[model samples]
Target: MNQRLKTIDLARGASVFIMIIVHTLWMFATPDLQGSSLFGTVIHILGKGTASFLVAMGISMALSRRQAPWLLAKRGAQLLLLGYVMNAAKFWLPIEVFNTMPESFINAYGWQSPLNSEQLKFMLLTGDILQLAGVSLVLFAVLNIARWKTHWIATLAVAIALSSEFVRGSQFTLLPYVSDLFFANNYQVYFPVFPWISAILTGYVLGRIYQQKQKDEQYLYKVCAWLGGALLIVGAAWLAVDFKGQFGNFFHLNGGGISYLIGLNLCALALLQYLFANKSSGPITRALLYASKHVTALYVIQWVLICWLMGVFGYHTLTLWPTLYLMVLVSLLTFAVHKLYLQSKRTTIGVMQKTKRTA
Candidate 1:
C-alpha cells in the first residue's frame, strides 16, 4: 500500500526507460543500422524481455492490495481508452506521407504496409501495452470479485497462452478487430496478449506468495533465488534445445523462450529486491524509482512522443551517429515530459482544492 515497494518500482521503472531507448532506436536508426540482423535480434530480445517483466510488476502491484480489484480495473480502462485514442490518431496521418518515406524507414519502424482503411482498422484493434495491461487488469479484477481464486486465474492464463499455439486458422487478417485480441494475425499488436497475460497472471501468483512472505527477507533472497534459478535453467534448456523453431518469435508466446525470460525476470526481480531492501540507493536507482512511481503517465507520454517523432516526422538523418543522438534526445524529452506531467498534476490538484474550499 505504501511507496515502500521500491523493488517492483525499480524493475518496472528501469524497464520503461529501456523501452523508450529501444523505441528510439526503432524510430531514429538509419537504414543500415536497422538492417543489421544482429542489432535487430538483440533489440528484439532486450525489448520483449524488459516489457514482460514490466507487465509482471504491474500485476504484482495490482494484486498487492486486498481492496484493489475495481480501482485497478478503472486504471486499466483509462489505459484502454488512451491506447484507442492514440492509435486512432494514426488515421489522420495521411498514407501519402508514409509513401514518401524511404522503404528502409518504413520497414525499420514496422510501418511497411501502406496506411489505409484496413491499416486504420488494424491499428484500432492492435493491443499496445496499455490495451493489454488494461485488459489484464480488468480480467484480473473481475476474477477477483467473482471469488474465482488465484489458482483458477493462473489456470485461465495458461489456457490463454496455450491457445496461441493450438488455436487454428489465421483469422486475425480476416477478422482484424475481433481476432486481434486473442491471437496474432493481421494485427501488428505488440506484446502478444495471450502469452503475455500468462506472464502477468503468473506474476499475480508470485505477488500473492510475496504478500504472504515479504516479512521474511530470507525467503525472498534465498528460497526465491533457488526457485528462480531453477526456472532460469528450465527456460535456458528449453531455448538451447529449440532456439530457432521455438524461441524464434520473442514477441509471440514461444513456449520455450517464455520459460527462459520468465526465469530471467524472476532472477532479476529477486536481485533487485535484495539490492533495494536496504535504505540507501544509487542515483540511477533513485531516478528509476521516481519514474516507476509514474508508470502509466510515463507510458502515455512515451506513446505520444513516439507518435510525434516516428509517425509525424518519421526519420531525419539516415546516418548512424544521428540515431544515437536521437535516442539521447528522446530520453531527454521523456524526462522533460515526466516533469511537466508532475507539474500539471500538482496544478490540477491545487485548482480542485481551491474550488472545494470556495464551495
Candidate 2:
C-alpha cells in the first residue's frame, strides 16, 4: 500500500504487458516483420522486457528482509520446477492449428523433429530457460551466504558481468553448464553471469533505495525522479550509437560494453521515478499495480500462454495490425486470470487465519 512501491508495481505491470506482446509477436510474425527497420526497431526494443524482469527480481531480493536461507532456496527451487514444467508442456504440444498450414513452416526452433526421445530429453534439459533460472538461483544462494555488504554484492555482480565477456569467447564456454551457477548459452546468444546477474544486483540496490526513501518528503522523490530520468537519457543515447554501428566489433556482449543493459536499467528507473513523483492514478496504473504484485504468477502464466499459442499455431504469416490486436487481447485475458489467482490466494490465507483463531 506504499505509494512509492506503487511505482514498482507499475513498472512491473508495464514490463509484463510488453513481454506478452513481444512473445506473441515472436510466435505469430515472421522474422522479416521484425527486421532492423524503423518499425522493426520498435519490436527489437520490446526484447528488453526480460532484462527488466530480471532486474526487478534483484530489486525484490534487496528489499527482502534477511530470512532463513532455506526459505529462499525453497522459493527459487519452486520457480525452477515450475519453469521446467512449462518447458515440458511447450515441447509436448503439437505445432499445427485449425488445418491452416502455411508454406515454409518449420518445426519449433527448440524442438526439432528427427531427434529421438532421449536426444530430445537431453536437449530439453540443456537448452531451456529453466536451466538458466535454476543456475541463477543456485548462484544467488551462494552469494547470499556471505550476506556481504551491499557494495561488495554490487562489486561482485559487476565483476561477473565483465568476466562473462571473456568466458563467452573462450574454450571454457561449456563451464556455464557445469558451473550451472552463473552462466548459460544458446547458440551464439549468451545470458551469462555478468550481464544477467548484474541485473539482480541492480534490483537489490533499487530495493534498498526504496526502503530508505519511501517515507521521505516530496522533494526527495523529485530528486530521485530526475536522477532516474538522467540515467535513462544517457542509456538511450548509447543505444542509438550502438544501433548506428558506431562501436563496430568492440561492442559484442563481453567486450566491456554496458550500452543496452545500462540503457534498459535507466529506462526502468526513469519510469519508476515518474510514477512516484506524479502519484499517477488511472485504470492502467491500477491494472499494472495489481499485475506487478503477482508478478511470479503472471510470468509463469504468460510463458505458458506463449508456448501454447506457438504449438497450436505454427509461426504462419499474419498481418501486422491484427497480430498486434491479438496480442493485446491475449495480454488482457492473461492479466485477468492472474488477478483471479491472486484473489484466491488471499482468500485462502484469510480463511487459514480465521481457522487458527477459532482453534
lDDT of each: 0.64, 0.58
Candidate 1, poorest ten consecutive residues by summed lDDT: 90-99
Clashing pairs in 2: 58-203, 58-204, 59-203, 59-204, 160-194, 161-194, 165-254
Highest TM-score against the true fold, candidate: 1
C-alpha RMSD of candidate 2: 5.0
Clashing pairs in 1: none
Candidate 2 segments whose C-alpha is farther than 4 A from its true place: 1-4, 95-114, 126-134, 169-176, 179-181, 187-190, 209-252, 255-259, 275-277, 339-359
Question: What's each prediction's clash count?
Answer: 0, 7
Candidate 1, 1-359: lDDT as tens digits: 34245566677778777788788776666556766656645665578665345445544554455446878788778878988876655333433443333445445546665655764565566677777777776776787778766668667755765565665224666665445555663336666565677677666665666566755545644544675688679867877887874467665655566656666777777786776646567898888877777777777677657656665456634355666676677777878988987899999999999999999
Question: Superposing all C-alpha atoms, what RMSD in Å does each candidate have to the true structure?
Answer: 3.8, 5.0
Best by lDDT: 1
Candidate 2 per-residue lDDT, tens place, 114-223, comes to 44676445434533344445556666677777676667775776676556645543434556344433433343223545456666666666566666776443433454
lDDT of 2 at 77: 79
